[model samples]
Target: MIRLDYPIVIEPAPEEEGGGYRARVPDLPGCISDGETRQEAVSNIQQAIMAWLAEARNLGWSVPSA
Candidate 1:
């Protein structure tokens, strides 16, 4: 199994963007998720991180370090 620890940035979504919390892994470009609450956004981002890493591996892309 691949193991990675990356920094995440969580903030409120813009009012025009539906008002949920948004989470993203800066080291993994385009890896993002959102939820109605901070906790949920965090959980979703964890899944996003896994998916992002898996895809990178599948494509033989170098994974960035935290």
Candidate 2:
């Protein structure tokens, strides 16, 4: 498995519901993950990025240059 070692930035957004944190990675389009807590949101984003990269590689898509 080819692993990509890069950095991802996560920013907090105002929650539409009662309360929570929203995370988004600018470098990865449509790559947004959120959770009730800031820590959780960031952690989920990392998992999301890993999955995205794996799927992209499997589909023979060009991995976005960070």
Candidate maximizing TM-score: 1
Global lDDT of model 2 = 0.73
lDDT of 2 by residue, 1-66 (tens): 544445556555665564677777776677778887889887888788888878888989888876
Q: Name model 1 segments beyond 4 Å from true.
A: none
Per-model TM-score versus the true fold? 0.90, 0.71
For 1-66, candidate 1 gives per-residue lDDT tens digits of 656578899999998989999999989999999999999999999999999999998999998976
Each prediction's number of clashing residue pairs? 0, 0
Q: Report the error of model 2 at residue 16, Å.
A: 3.7
